[model samples]
Target: MNVTGDDVRSLALSLPETTEQFAWGMPIFKVSGKLFLTLPEGETSMAVRCPILDRDELVLAEPAKFWIAAHEAGNAWVRVYLSALDDREELTAIVTDSWRQAAPRALLDSP
Candidate 1:
């Protein structure tokens, strides 16, 4: 099964409750205006804001696209190749994690 931008959007929307918008000319999934993920038109790959340690690990594992050591957000985010995802299950988990981190507990508690 091929992953598409629609899949990305759907995954993001599936989160508890969040918002979608664009930033830096790319699609951004956020909660209360803070970006959680960003991807270009095709959504072939996505960048998730991460801590310095996690970013280091990802860059070492996949040096080609998972660039770091020099970035706009520096060590605050890392790009994840959509193709690197073993299956839709992993993709969903990762996307959900990003959303959960971005979404505040209060928002999730909202009825």
Candidate 2:
């Protein structure tokens, strides 16, 4: 299945404290000003916060679906191919995980 910008926007926005912002000619999803996801390359791909170690492993394990752009190489982030995503559930999991990483302690602990 293929995921689109709308899918990204909807899933990301459903998370707590999430908001959409346009930057660098693309859509970015943030949690209280801390960005968790960005849709670039015409929304065909997304960059999300991931642990540095997990980022490398994801890219290595599934190069077709995950990667690290050169500009973000020094950061703790990974890019995911929307087209490679299996379904909305998968996207939600990914977005939620990133959201957890960016969300504040209070938000995380909130019901």
Candidate 2 residue-wise lDDT, 1-111, digit = tens: 878989889889988889999999998999999999999999999999999999999999999999999999999999999999988889988989999999999999988
lDDT of each: 0.72, 0.93
TM-score of 2: 0.97
* Candidate 2 colliding pairs, count: 0
Error of 1 at 29 (Å): 1.2
In the order shown, what is each candidate's alpha-carbon RMSD?
2.7, 0.7
TM accuracy, model 1: 0.78
Question: Which lDDT tens digits does candidate 1 get at residues 2-111?
Answer: 66677878888777655788777878888777678888636778877667787787788877647642454554777777766678897787777777667778986788
| TM-score of each model, in listed order | 0.78, 0.97
